[model samples]
Target: MPHLPDSVHVMTDDTRPHTATPTTEGVWSVRGTRITADRTPEGLRLRARAGAEGLSRIVLRWRLDTPEDARILGDAWERGYGDLQWRTLQPDRALPWYALITGGAFGGPTTGWGVRTRPGALCSWTVDESGIALWADVRSGSLPVLPGEREVDVATVVTAAGPTPFAAHEALCTAMSPDPLPAVGPLVGCNNWYYAYGRDFGPDAVLRDARTVVEYADGHPVRPYCVIDDGWTEGGGSAPGGPWDTGLPGVFDDMADLAARIAETGARPGLWFRPLLSRTETAAVRPGLLRDSGFPLDPSLDVALETVAEDVTRFRNWGYGLIKHDFSTYDVFGRFASHSPAELALPGWSLSDRSRTSAEILVRLYGTIAEAAGDAVVIGCNTVGHLSAGLVRVQRCGDDTSGRSWERTRRMGVNTLAFRLAQHDRFFTLDADCVPCTPRTDWRLNRRFLDLVARSGTALFVSVDPAARTDRTDADLAAAVRLALDGGTPGGVEPLDRLSTTAPRRWRSGAETLVHDWAEPWGAVPLAV
Candidate 1:
C-alpha cells in the first residue's frame, strides 16, 4: 500500500511544473505550472496553472489509434463499485485510470475511464488509470490553487465517442455534469443495512421494513422504498460518528410516527442521515468543529452548515420520501478505502473555511444537503461522483452488498453491476448495491444476483434477512421485486470475461449473453483489495 512514486504519483504530481507552450488551439503554459489546451464543443479544453495560483494538479497524456483488445470503463472512485478493475492492453502492461473532483487518489472519486472496442464502440474518461499505458489523474486535487490558470472545471477531460456502451455512458454522462432531473425512476427498494448491519433495527424494525416494502410491493406499480438503514438515530454506541436528532428514545419513538407509520404501508419512507457525523459520546460536539476524523463535523464550517441544514430540514419535515445522505466523502475527506486525493493533502490543510475549494467545499456541502432535501429523494450515500452530480437523485454506485456473503454479493454486487453499468441513468440513478436474499447467501448465487439486478437497468435494492426466512421465499423476493419494479431492460453491459476477472464472469445484457461462476455457489472469495 505504499505506491506513490511514478514521479510522485497521485496521478502524476511531480511537484508541479512541466512547462508547455504554443497556444491558439491546444497548448499554453507558464513556469510554476500553467497549461491549457482548447477545442471545445465537448472534447478538448484542458487547462492548468500555478503562476497566478490554481495549480494543484495537471497530468495529461493522450495518444490514440487505439484497439488492442480495448475494454475499460470507469465511474466510482468511491462507495463500492464492488472491486471494479477491468483491463486489456498488456503487451507489457499499462492500464492506469483516474478522474476526481474531491475524494481523489485512493479514498475513491477516481470517476473516469472507458475504452471499448469489439465492434460496439465506446470512449469515456475522467480519473486514474495506468493501463492502456498511462493517463494518470488528479487533474486537480484538494483545491484552491487558483489565481490564474482556469479550465479545471471539475478537472476537465470530457470525451464521448459513442456507438454503444450505452451511447458512451450517455455521452460520458452528458459530458460529465449538468443533467440531473431524470427524476431517477427505478429504485425497487428495502434497505435495512444488509439485514440490520448497524446491529438490529427499530421503529418496529423500521415499520416492519415498511411492512416489508408494502409486502414487497404487492401493489406493484413501482412504489417500494423502505430504506431506514444505519439504525434510526441516537448513539448505538458510536456509528458514523453517532447522534442524529429526533427518534430513538426506545428506537424511533416518533420520527413523525415513523413517517406516519411508513405512510400506512403504501410504502415510501427512507431515512439514513450521517450528514458529516457527530457522536462525541452522543452529541454536543464542537471541539472547534472537529475533523481529521475526531467526530467529523466540519463541512468547512458555518457550524457545519447550520447543523447540516438543520438535519436536512428535519428529514424534510419528517414526511420523508427518501433522504439517504451517508458518509459525505468520508466525512469531508478524512479519507476512505485506500486514500489518494494526493494522500489527503486537503489542499495543504489550514481550513475552517479559507474561502472555498475542496471542490468548492464539496459543492457547498452537497448544496447544503441538497437544500435541506426539500421534496425528499436525495440518496448520495458515501457520496461525491463529480460533486454528487446535480446534487443526487440516487448514486450509491458501489461497495456494500453482502447480507453475509455470496462471496460478498459476488464481490459487491456483481462487480458494481458489471462495471458501473454505464452510470445507469447517466450518473445519478446507478445504485449498484443490495440483493442480499440471505440464508447466509447462495440461492444458487443469490439467484444470479437477482437476475442481474433485475436486468441491470440500475438501482434495485433488496436486503431481506428476517433470519433468512426459512431459506428465502417472499415468493422468491416477490419475483425479484417484480423484475426490479416492472421488468426493467434498457440494456448494455457486455464485459464477456474481462481480460480475466476482477469479477467479470462473462456478460452482455441487451442482446443476451451469459456465463457465471463468480466462484461458483461460493468457493474462492479472495480478491478484496
Candidate 2:
C-alpha cells in the first residue's frame, strides 16, 4: 500500500468525549458518525454519516509533514458575481503550509481545499460548510435537527486523484454533480449586456446583433444565438412580480414576433432577466414575500416560487429558446459577492418554510425554473455553483469581465477560465462571460480573451458594440466560433499555469500549447468618438 496521509477527524461537539476505533476495513466509528475513508485506485473515498446522533459536519483534516513552504487553492464560494471582492486565494504572506480558513467560515461547509502537490487532489462536499458549523444551511437559516430523526446522510466528499490539478477538479466535479452531463453542442453566441449595459436595447438592436451572429456563422453547421440582455423589461426597473410582459410597449412591440425575427436571422433568441427582482407592476399582481431591498421577491416563500415558475413559463411561451436568470443568491441572502457563504448565514432569520434546507430551497427554485422552461436552455448567474450544478444547463461561472478595463477582463475573465475551466461540462457549461469587443477596451487584449473563450470549450458569448464592428470582423473571431462550435480540442483543454498565477498566460489544448501575455497591452484604448 502506498504511504497515505493520516486522517484526523475534527468535530464541533468537543464536549462529548468520543473515541474513534477502526471497526471495519477502511471505516472508523467516531461519535455517532461513521468515518469511512480509503485510498482507492481512482483516489480517496471519504464519507461521514450519523444514523442516531444526526450528523452535521465532520472534517477529516490532514497535515503536511514539513509545513515549511506550502500553498493552498480554494475556489470562490460563488463565481465573482457580487461585491467583486472574493479573489482566488494566493495568500500574500506565506505561512508554514497552513492558511486561515479562506473557504467557508466556521459555521458553514467548505467544499474542498488542496495543497500545491500532486497527483492533484480535489475534494467535493455534500453539505454547505456553513450548515455543519453554525447549523445554518447555505440557503435556509440554521435549523436544529429534530430528535429521533432516522438518520443524517451527509453527501460523499471525494478527494479525487489525478496527475494534475485540472484532472482532479474534473473528477471532483463529476463526483459531485447529480445530473448527468448534457449532450450540449457549442453555444457560440452574442450577448448584449457588455455593450448595452442594460441601458438601451430593444427588438431592432437585438435583431441587428442576431444578424451579426448569422454573418459570423458564415454557413457553420452549428447555428449561432443572440441574447437580449436586461433592458427588455416592461416598465423596466427592479421590483417584485410582473405582468412579466416582454419589452416596454413599442420597443419590442411583440416579443413572440421579436423572437421569430431573431430566428429568421438564423440565430436562436435568448433573454436575460433578474427573475427575483421585478417591476412594480409585477409586484401588484403577484405580491409575495420581499427581500431586504423591499422589491425583489423573497424566494423563501411558496407563493414567490409559484410566481417564478409562472414568469419563466411566460418566457418559454414567448418563444425565447434560452433564459438567463441572475441574482437569486444575492436576493435570497441579501448579500452580494463580498460575503462568503459562511458570512451570509443568519440564524435569527428563518424562511417562510423552515422545513427545507438552503440547498434544498435553491434546488427547488432552480428545478422550478428548469421545469417551467421546458425546452429552453437555462443559464444561472450570481448563483451558488455547487447548488446550481445540475439545475442549470449553463452557469455564468465568474464575475463580469470589463469592456472598459483590460485588467478587469484579465482578472475576472481569464482567471476564471483558467481555474474553473475544469467544471466546463460537469456542473454546467461554464460561461466565463462575453468577450467584450468595444472601443473602450484594448482589442489586442480582448482578441486574445476571445480566442481563449472560443477554444476553451465553454460557452462563447461575444458582446459586440456597434462602434467595435470592425474589431469583431477579425478572422480570429470566426475561427474561434468554428473551434468553439466544434467542441474545442479533445482530451479537454487545461490551464497549465492556474496554480502559479491568477491570470495564466499558458494553456495546453490537447496537441497545441497556447500562450498569451494578458498583462502586455498591445496598444492604448482608442478614444471614444
Candidate 3:
C-alpha cells in the first residue's frame, strides 16, 4: 500500500508553523486557510487557500518505513543545476520535483516519490531516516502570500516502486508530467555559441555553419538545424541582453533574408534570444513592468508579456523554424538555480502583481512564448524544467558544455545527460547542451560524448569550429548526425552505472552494450568550471 502524508503544516511570513486541523475526510484548515487533498490514481492532488497571515511554504510529512541506510536521488531546479548522483540522505537538502530511495546496495530495487502539478508552487523534497518532507514554496520572490489572494493549486504527491532505479525514475517522471509537447522530428543540429561564443560572427559565418551541418547530414529525411546563437542582435555579444528589434547593423542586416539563405542550404534556421531583457527602453517599460532597474521585465505585467509575445512573433515571422528562448529564469529571479531554498530568490521584493504566485507568473511567461511561437519548435534554456514541461518542445537539460574545458563537459554534460535522461520525451526532448569540436578540447573525449547523445535518441547539437574540422572529425560528425537523424538505436540508450557515479561510463544501446572513457590525461578538474 502507498504511504500517505501523516500531517500538513503551513509556514507563514512570521516564521511560525501552523498545523492544519482536519475539517473533512480530505480537507483541513488553519485559521482562515483551507487545505484539500484529493486522492487520485497518480497521487494526491493538494490545494490551499491563503488567509490574512501570508504563507511561505506548505509542508507535507510522511513517516519512513524503509531501511535506515537507504541512498537517495533528487533533482535540480533548472539546467546548469548539477551535482546529481545518489548519495546518503541529507535531511536539509532541497530535492526538486522528486526523490528516489534505494536499499544501499548497487543495482538494488528502488522506490520513488514525486510531485505532479502545473507547478502553481515550487515543490521540493527533504528526507531523513525517521520521516520525509515535501516543501511547496509559494513565496513571491522573498515575500509571503499576502491577503486576498487566489487559491493555490499546490502539487500532487506520487509514489512508485520498481526493480531498478531507472525503471522507478522513469515511472515517476511519467506520473509527474502527464502531458508533454514532444519534438516533431529528430533534433539534430549545429549551434554556433560554443565555437564562436556569439562574437565576431555574422550571416556569412552562420551560413557556413548551415552548409556544414547540411553537408554532415548527407540528405537525411529529417533535416538538421543551424542556429544563430546570441550574437545577431544589435548591441549583443557573448553575454547578450536584448532590444531584439533589429539585427546587428551591417553584419546581419535583413533577418528574413538570412533565414531564407539558411533554408537554402537545406537546413532549418533557428535563433536564440534573451526575451525578458533589453539594452534599451521599449514599450514594455512602465512603472510596474520592472522588478528593479536595468531591464529585467516583470513577467506579471500584461504590457511586459505583450512585449515578449511580440518578440517571439517577430522571430517566427522572420522565417525561422526553431526558437531557443533563454535566461528568463535568471532574469526573473535575479539568480541561477545554484541556490538553496533560503536563497532561492533575492530578499524583500515581490512581483508587481501580488495576486499570483511566482510559479504562476513563470507559467504564464512560458505559455506566452509557446502560443506566440506557432509552428516553430520552442526550446527553453535556463528555464525551470518542471514548469516548462508541457509548453516547450525541447529543453536544455544541463548547463553549458564547454569548448575550452573537458571538465565542464564531463561534470555538466555527462552528469546531466546520465541523470536526466529519464525525462526525455516524458517532459520534453532533453538537450544536454552541445558537443563542441574546438582546438582547446580533445576530440577523443568529445567523440565519445557525441556518440552517446546520438545513440540516446535525445536532441543532438554539435558546435564545430572551422579550425577543428579534419577528415576524421568530419567522418565522425557525419556518422553521429545521421544516427541522430535516424532516431538513434532501436530500443534507445540506458545508463548502466547510474547508481554509483554522476557520469555513467557504461550504456546499453539497443542490443549492444558500450563503454566509454570520459577521463582526460590529467583526470577530471576538481571544480565544475
Candidate 4:
C-alpha cells in the first residue's frame, strides 16, 4: 500500500494514508478526502462521485503521520485508469476535493465499495492516524439499526485532479446568483428512431412521416423538444459522400418551415445523432471507422468517431435546439475471441492505458459536442455511465428502449430508478427510459413507472403520439407529463428478502414517498396516493 493523498471519503477517524489497489478489493488509502459516512454494525456508508470520480485519482483522506508508517503501508505501485497525481495537503486544509457524499461500506444488502469474498465479513479498516480537524463521532455501543435504512457511512474522496470539494461546495452555494437564464422547462422531446432506427430498411417511409408528431407536440401546454431522427443529416453536405449529404434536399429547408410551425406550437427542434456511429448503412461512416466486417469495430479511435467539428456547428446553426449524441460504445468490449465469456475477455488495449484513453475519448467527444452546439442540451447514449458523468447534464437514466419500448421501458425503468437514486446529485436530470404507456396492458403500471422516475429528478422525453392514443389515454398521458413537469423524489431499492440480486422486496421510488414490492418480477401491486 502506497500513501495516497486525495480527499475521497467522509466522516469517522481519518484514514488518508491507507492505500488502495485498483483491483476491486485492494487496499484503499488516501489523504484528506471527506468521508461523509453513516455507520452500522455491518460497515460504513459510501457513495462515489457519479460524474466526478473515476478510480484514477481517488485516495482516502486521513491525517498524515510519520513517513515510517506511510512507507510500511505504501508500495510504489500505480494501478489502472489514470496515473497518480499527488500533492501534500498542509495539515490545516483537510483534503476536501468534492461536493458529493462520496462512497461508503456496509454489510448485507447495501451498495458495495469493498468486500472480501473469502472472509464474508466487512473488512476491518486499518486505522493509520487521527489528529487535528476530525468530525466523526465514536459509536458507544453500535449504530442505530433502522429497519429500511441500510447501515451505511459516507466519505468524500478526491476522485480526480479537477473539481475540488471546496470548489463544488462554493458553486452549489452560489448556484442561485440572482435572476438567471430562462428556466429551460424540461422539454417533452422524442428522437424518432428510438423505437428502432428507421435506417435499417433504408429510411422507412414512416420517418419522413413523423412530422405529425412534431406538429401535434406544438399544441402542448409547455414547449416540446422534438427531434428528427437519423435519416435527415441536413448539412453534412460539405462532405458530399458524408451521410448527411444523401438526405432529401430541402430537409432543413422543410424543417426550417417546420421550425416556424413548431415555434407556433411552442416546441423546440432537437435532432438525433449516433455521433460515434456512422453506419456503413449510411455513407457518413468513413471506411476507416468500420471493422472490415462490423459489430466489433473499435470505438476508442478518432477515425472510428467521425468527429467533423464543422458538421456539428452546422447542426446547431441549422436551428436544432437539442442534440442526442449516441453510440460511442459500438463494441461491448474488445474481447479477443468471439463469444468469449467473462473468463476469457481481456481489457482492450492496456488496462492501465486504455481505460484512461476511453475516459479521454468520452470527455473530448462530449466537450466537442458541447462546444460545437453552444448551449444546446446534450444527451449521451450507450456511453457507459461513468464515462458520461458530470460532463453531460442529462443522460439516459436507463438504456435506450426503442422498438421494444415496453420491455425496454420496464427493465430500463428499474435500472434508471436505481441508477438515478445512486447518482441523482451528479447531474440535474435523468432521462428516464422513454415511456409510451398506453391504455394497453400494464398501462397504469407503466404510468406509475414514469411518474416514479420523473418525480425523483428532472425527467425529459415522451413517446406517446397523442394523435394515435385514445382521448382518455391522452388525458392520463397529459397528467403524467404534468406531474413530471412538477417533479418528485428519487428512488432507492431496499432488499427485503435475504441478499439476492433477482429482486428487492420494498422498491421505493421517492425520498419518503411509497415503496412497491417487485418480489416476483411482474407483480403489479397497487398503491394509493
Candidate 5:
C-alpha cells in the first residue's frame, strides 16, 4: 500500500493559515496556489505553485502508526552543523532533510522519512505522538513567496524500511539523490587550514606542505592532493572576504607557478577561494549585486554570478586540478547553519531577486561554479549537500575540526562522520573535514581518526603541522595515506554505536569491529575555538 499524507496545510507571511481545499486524490489548492503530490516507486514527489498572495510554507501531515517509544535520528543543515544522534522524540526539534525511526514495535527494521535536498525550498520534519509533519519552507528569505503562479519544485519525500537503521538511511539517501557526481579517484590529500588557518603561508610554505603529502603517499599510483587553502588571494591573511582575481602581491606572486611547483612534487595541486565574497570595490561589484552594504556578493545577481564564473575559470587555467570553494551558504544567507534557526536563513532580509527562493539561488550559484570548473574536481565547503549533489564531486559533510582543541573535533567531526556517513557517495564523497595533527591536539586521538577516515573510503585530508610530526606520527600518516590512495578498506566502514553516542566509539570494518577511546583523562571540555 502506498503511504500518502493525510492532510495538507499552507501558510503565508507568518504562521497564519490559508485554507487548502482538496481538489483531487493527491492535489490541494489554496487561494491561487496549487500543490501536487505524485506517488513514485521509491516515495512521493511534491511540487507547488505560488499564488499572488505569495506562499510561505506547504506542510504535509502523516498519521503515526509506530510505537511511541521509537528512537529517532535526524540530519543537519549543511557542513559544520552537528549535534546528530538517535534519541527520544523531541516534538518541536527540526530534522533537516531526513529523519529515521527505529526500535519499539519494529524489532529489527528501521523506518526512515527523508525529503530530497535538491528542491527550491528548505525541507524539515517534526514528529510527535500523533503524527509526522514535513514542512517545506518556500519563503523567499523570511517573507512569503511572491513568485506568481510559476510551479516550484518543493521536495521529494522518500521512506524506507530496512533491516537496520544504517541500511534504511542509506536507501532513503539513494532515493533522495539519484545522480551524484562521481569522485575523482581516491580523495586523500593534505589541507593546511587547520594548522595554518589562512595566515603566514607563502609559496614556499605551500610547496613544503605539498612535498610532505607527496612524501607520505610514497609513490602510490593515485597522487595525493595538496590544497593551498585560503590566504592565497589579494589582501592576504585570515580575513574572510576576497578579491580572488590575483595572488597576494608579494607572497604569492604567481599562482600558476605555485601550481606547477606543487605538481612537480608528484601531488595534485588544489586551490581554495571564497567566491561569493570580495573586498575589491569595483564597477563590476555594484551595490545592486550585494544583499547588504557589505562584502557578500548576492548570488541572485547575474553580475555577481559572472564574477564567480570568471574567478573559477581563472583557477582552472592556473592548472589546479581541485578547487575547494568555501562559505557560499554563509555569504548567501549571512549565517552558518549552526547559528541560523530551523528556517535555515534569518528573516527580515530577502534576496535582490525576490522571485526565486534561497534554494533556487544557491542551485544556480553551484551550477555556475560547476560549469566554470569544467574538468576540475569541485569540493564544496560550507555548501548545502542536497543542492550541490550532482554539481560537486565532494561535499564537506561536517563543520571544521580543531587543531587548537580536541573537544571541538570530538563534538563536530566525530558526530558528523558517524551520522552523515550514510550520505557518502550516495550524495557526494562525504568529507568529515580534516584530521588535524598539531601540537595543541593529541596525536593518539588524531591517529585513530586518521585510520577511520582512510578506512571509510571517503575523502581523507590531514593537516600535518611540521612541529607536530614525530617518528610515530609520520609512520601512522604514511600508512593511512597509502591505504586511502588504495581506496580504503574493501568492505568500507560502519558506525556500531551511532544510536547511543554523538561521537561513536565503535565501528565495523570488514570482519573486524574496532573501538577507540575519544575521551582524554579529564573527559570532554566545552567546545571552544
Candidate 6:
C-alpha cells in the first residue's frame, strides 16, 4: 500500500505567533511549506517530531486540576528524588528528562487524571478561572522532540476563564456501544494486576500473603484471578540505583501462590507484565535461553514467558485455571535520552530508527506472548489497541487514570474510549481499565463516569487494590461490577447532547450539573471553546 503523501501533513496555522514574548517558548520548523510547532503548553506536552514518516504527536496531558491534591503527579515526576534521567536519541546527543510545571497549565476546569516520566519532558500544574491541576509526560523516540528549539503553544484569549481539562474548543467523537450491556452474564473475578505488578513497591501491602488476595475474590459476582504488575525481577522504581523493592525472586512460585489464592476465591488469577520491554544485561534474564533477535531484548519473550508456562503446567498438575496476561505500552515507547545515566538499551543499527523499532518490536512481542500464554486472559495497557486485537482477550483501552477531579472524567479516559470504539468488540473484550478500581470516596459521581466508559457491553473486569477498600461504600463498586459482570447499567450509557465539533461524540457521565461543550466535527477549530 502506498503511504499517504506529505500533502496530507496539516499543521494548524493559527498556532503561530506574529511576535515572540519572553513568557512564550516553543519552536516552528518549516518543511516545504509545512510548519511544525513544537511548543510547550505550560511545559505540559511531551511530543515527538517525525523524520517525515512517523507519527507526530501533540500530547496535551490530562491531570488533576489542583496543586496540593496533585501529589499523585509528584509520585510519577518525583521532584525531590532529583531529576530522573534516561536515554533519548541515544548513543549520540543524549537528552535528560525532567518534570516542569509552567504554572497556569491546569487553568481549565474539572477533568480526568494520570502520569508518566521522561527527561526534557515536562508536567504543568496551574489554575485560572477553571480549577486546580497537574499533568506530565515525555515524548517517545517514535517522534524526535527537538530540544532547545522554538515551539508554539496555542493561547486562546478567553473572555471567561474555564476550569475543564478538555482542550479549548475540541470536538468529541463518541461511539455508544451498539450492544446492550444489560444482556451479559453474571461475573466473579480478581482485579488484573499485571505480571510486573507483583509484591513490588515496598512489599505487597494488600496481597501480602498471595493467599489473601485469592481469599477476597471468593464471593464477588465477577471472578478475576489475581494479576500482578511490573517489578517482578531484578530491580525497578525510579531507575536502578534508587530504592528498588517489589516482587520476590521466584516468578513462577509467586504466580502459583497467587493462582492458588484465586482458586480459593472461586476466581481466576491472572499475571501482568511489560514482556517486550526488558534487558538481557540483568541477572533476572536467564542466560542463553533468549535468542539474540537483535531487536530490543524483551526478557519475557526470552525467559519470563517460559517460566509462566512451566508455572501454569504446575497449576495444571494441581488443576489451576487460566492466566491474565498484561502489557504496558509506555515502556515499549519510552523517551529516554541515550546520554542519561539511567538509560536502558534499545538495540539499534542506527540512531534515528529507535522509536520506530520499539513500536515494531512490540507488534512482534504481542503475537509471541499470546502464542505462549495459551488461553490466558491477556490484557494490555499503555497499549496500542489494534495490535493486540485477538492477541489478548482483553486490552486496557484507557489509562488506569483515576482521580477525584470531576474534569478527569472527560480527559484521557473518554478520549481513548471515543477514538478506539471500533475495536471495542472487534477481536476481544475491551477493558476500560480500572474505573471502579477507585475506592468509593465519592459514590454517585464516581460510578457514573466509570459506567459510561463500560460502554459496548464488552466491559471485562474491574480493579481496585485488594487493599483498595473504601471508607465510603462497596455499594457503588459492587453496583458497577454487577452491572459489568451481571451485565450492565439498566439503560446503558446515556450520552449527553452534542458538545463538540467532533464526530461520534460523547458526554459520558457528567457531574449532575453537567454543563459543557460538545465536539462538532468539521468544527471551527481544535480547542476553540
Please write out the lDDT profile of model 1 over residues 337-396, one tens digit for every residue: 432222333443434543334555666777788788866888886765655666777778
lDDT of 4 at 115: 17
Candidate 2, which segments miss by more than 4 Å at Cα? Answer: 1-67, 81-139, 142-152, 234-243, 280-294, 338-341, 471-474, 520-529
Q: Distance from true position, residue 37, model 5, in Å? A: 1.4
Error of 4 at 266 (Å): 1.9
Q: Tens digit of lDDT per residue, candidate 4, span 1-529?
A: 1123333333222233233333233223233222233233333333222122212122344443322122110000000011111222223322111112111121111111221111101111222324212222111111211112222222221111114222322232222111122334554555545433443322223333244344444355655566665556533311112333234564443544554554444556766665543334433332333442332223334543444455566667667677766545433222221111211123223211232223344445556666777787766665444334445556654444433334444444554454233334444345655666433334555555655555654554656532346765556556655555554443322222211222222444443535544322554323310
What's the lDDT of the predicted structure labeled candidate 1? 0.58
Residue runs of model 3 more than 4 Å from their true location after superposition: 1-4, 14-16, 104-108, 147-149, 282-293, 339-343
- Once fitted onto the true fold, the runs of candidate 1 whose alpha carbons sit more than 4 angstroms away are 1-52, 56-209, 212-255, 258-260, 263-269, 272-304, 316-322, 326-356, 363-382, 385-395, 398-415, 420-474, 478-496, 500-529
> What is the per-residue lDDT of model 5 for residues 1-529, given as tens digits with 9 covering 90 to 100?
2266888889977866666888998899987888999987646888898878888898899887656787888777777455777889878888888878887443246877887667888888888777888888888777777786678888878876678889988987887888888768789999998899888889888889999999999989999999988788655545456667678888898899999999999999999988887775654443644433347787888988998999899999999989999888877777778822578777687877778888888889999999999999999998988788899999998888989888878888888789888899899998999999999999989888899999999999999999999999999999999999998999889999887888889999889999989998998875455
Question: C-alpha displacement of 292 in model 3, angstroms?
Answer: 12
Q: Which candidate is the best by lDDT?
A: 3
- Whole-model lDDT values for every prediction: 0.58, 0.62, 0.85, 0.38, 0.84, 0.35
Compute each candidate's TM-score over C-alphas: 0.36, 0.77, 0.96, 0.54, 0.96, 0.47
Give the distance in Å from residue 360's predicted Cα in candidate 5 to where it truly belongs: 1.0
lDDT-based ranking: 3, 5, 2, 1, 4, 6
Question: Which ten-residue region of model 5 has the weakest summed lDDT?
Answer: 285-294
The lDDT of model 3 is: 0.85
Winner on TM-score between 2 and 3 is 3
Task: Give a tens-digit lDDT track for model 2, residues 138-170.
Answer: 223444232243333223333333444555556
